[model samples]
Target: MSETQNFIILGGSGAGLGVAHSFLKHIEPELRKLGKKYHLYIIDSSSHFFWNTGSPRSVVSAALLPAEKLFAPIADGFKSYDSSLYTVIHGTAVSWDVGGRTVTVELANDQNTQTTLPYYALVLATGTRTPSPATSLHGDHTITKAAIEDLNKKFASAVSVIVSGGGPTGVEVAGEAGHFLNGSAGWFSSRPSNPKAKVTLVTNRDKLLPVLSKPRALTAEIYLNQVGVDVVYNVSVVSSTTDADGKTTVHLSNGEQWTADVYIPAWGITPNSSYAPADLKNDQGYIKTNHATLRAEAAGPRVYVAGDVGDYSRGGFHNLYATIPVIVANIKRDLLEAATSSDGSDSQPNEPDRLFTPNNSETQAVPIGPRGVGAVNGWGLPSFLIWLVKGRDYMIRNVSATVNGNMV
Candidate 1:
């Protein structure tokens, strides 16, 4: 019998889940042809995978749609595969011994108990950690969904809403809140028509969606303005305090002050690479990778990385979509080479691992309410297409379909 190699993937979101599903549905068949056996273990602290790209809108519309739609069980994606071939561990990866090819994970059910996993290869797709509603990293979908639902209740009654950050998340939040108040008749009936009832967006940059093309940025600003969202540019939130009345006062770097009943900070995310070797990380703590191969720079060739945790020039769903295929290909190549080698011997250098060549460029789609705007490969997209593609339901329906086994 061939020795069964172990492949451990640490993450259950976009990149990690993408590779795992593709491997089971596509690559595993090829490996079976080579008469190689392996156990693929996917570990994540959360039992369910949160579709964070749609989180902004989901949080705002929690009352209209079921919170369950925002999360999908990680194990559900692997149901079609053989039980012995793949296992999903519900735990947080705390530490790793790269030299020994062992990883320590903190089990979600029992925090005090830890489990060590030995692997022939490891794929790091832990992604990033961000504030709730922007990216839920609570490791529990129920808690995250409940928190967002409570926040939506707060938003429903709030006279004023302030969202800090001009990036995609903030823009989406502002747009969704504004649209909910202006468009939702049932939600609007409760609140009095005070002009003060506003959705304010604060950003340090001069333009909304600064990383996007100028045309796209302008389009986004126009959409937000049309939806009654106040875009406050060139200002940063210095501090915030809540008063007895429950209204919070936000102090800005420009010496401006604003009071709002609801406040959300969508500033950014921190890369979830605490287990990564210091030498493999950049100043911002993102794992440095060989972009061509998606391999960790300082880690051995057996280790790879993808998604937001990777030190790619840009991090987004489109980038992840383009990157995961490369990661899967490289992992398959390495596995095939290992399978061809004789017992206890490394394969000759005749066949090298395939390099990941990215065919797609940086692409972003920022949905604002029923309208949308974005750029793909330096080309701007029309509002109708953006609306049809993402703004309609913020891709929630698509994610829900995948969870229902329709698109998976």
Candidate 2:
């Protein structure tokens, strides 16, 4: 047998986990056949995978969904695997030397230092980050839980709240908060009533979902209204500041200013690709990935990419899921074919059967205050169907399956 092949997967979220688990599941047997040994390393700053799909509702009212339901130990997903097969590192990848096949990881420790690891294959899947701390889970799920709890406390007795961005996160949050503050019942009616509370959503785009056509996009705005969420369009947030008193003030593109007790920004996502090499990145700092093979051309041998951090697709769950197998396959094939290479060098892996084509069609299921709206392949989905499929429990029940790689 040859030296143990080390596979380093940076980012332990949905896309990263999928790549790691799927690779771990199938690679060992294939490597054994090739007289090779391998080990997988999963790296991330967070120990748990926060089921952020449920954040809109979860943030509004914990009574509707408990904090425990939104987070699960990521390491536990691989409990069935032998401990010798993989190692889970709680840390952040700060940099990587593609030429050296080493990644610099800033460990989640009290000491202020970083560690490096040698790898045969490096998978970049750190995903993206929202500007506002309240909008996304970073560091750890526990810290995110605390932020949500604090946000709820600030808005509990408030009369008004403003959410920036008309994207799914903003739209959904506005709808959920609107329903609760206005005393509308969702999963539970035990939420304390504050019928006078106003929830508003301000979007820079002319339409709610700019990705979809007029009539289809109008569905989101219409549903938001039904839930008492005031939708404001064609507006950009100039600046937002919070006072020491916990009140927030926002300046809009229309030269209008609005002050609210709570301000939530879900405007945009910045790809978490700081550690990726500049030559492998696009204009937006997102790693430039081969659409079909999911390989990073300039990153040299065995560097693959998956999920939002990559520039191959417009960033979505389906695209991420589709890219996983291509990455894993290319990695396996590269290793198999490169066994005889003098030095670690790119084989220019192109697995025809594992090619991934990004789906350009607009497809999404967006929940609005317990009910929902969605469109797939130019066809609108019924609210009840959206409710039945995704809105009911925000698919929290599938968190286990998702983490365990069953859904991948």
TM-score for each of the candidates? 0.90, 0.93
**Cα lDDT tens digits for candidate 2, 1-408:** 777878889988888898888877787777777677888999988898877788887777678776678888989999888899899988888888888889999988744889989998888888888866556667766788887888778767878989999988898888888877775534443333445687889998888877667786687776676666778888999998889999999989899999999888989888888887788788899998777878886787678888888887676666767777777777778876676456554544444437888788878878887677787876788889988988888889878987898976
How well is each residue in 282-375 modelled by candidate 1, as lDDT tens digits?
9999988888888884777578897889887377666667787678877777777777777642343355656665535536788887778887
| Best model per TM-score | 2
Reference-based lDDT, residue 186, model 2:
44
RMSD of 2: 3.3
Tell how far residue 376 is off in model 1, in angstroms.
2.3
Summed backbone clashes in each candidate are 0, 0
CA-lDDT, candidates in order: 0.78, 0.80
Clashing pairs in 2: none
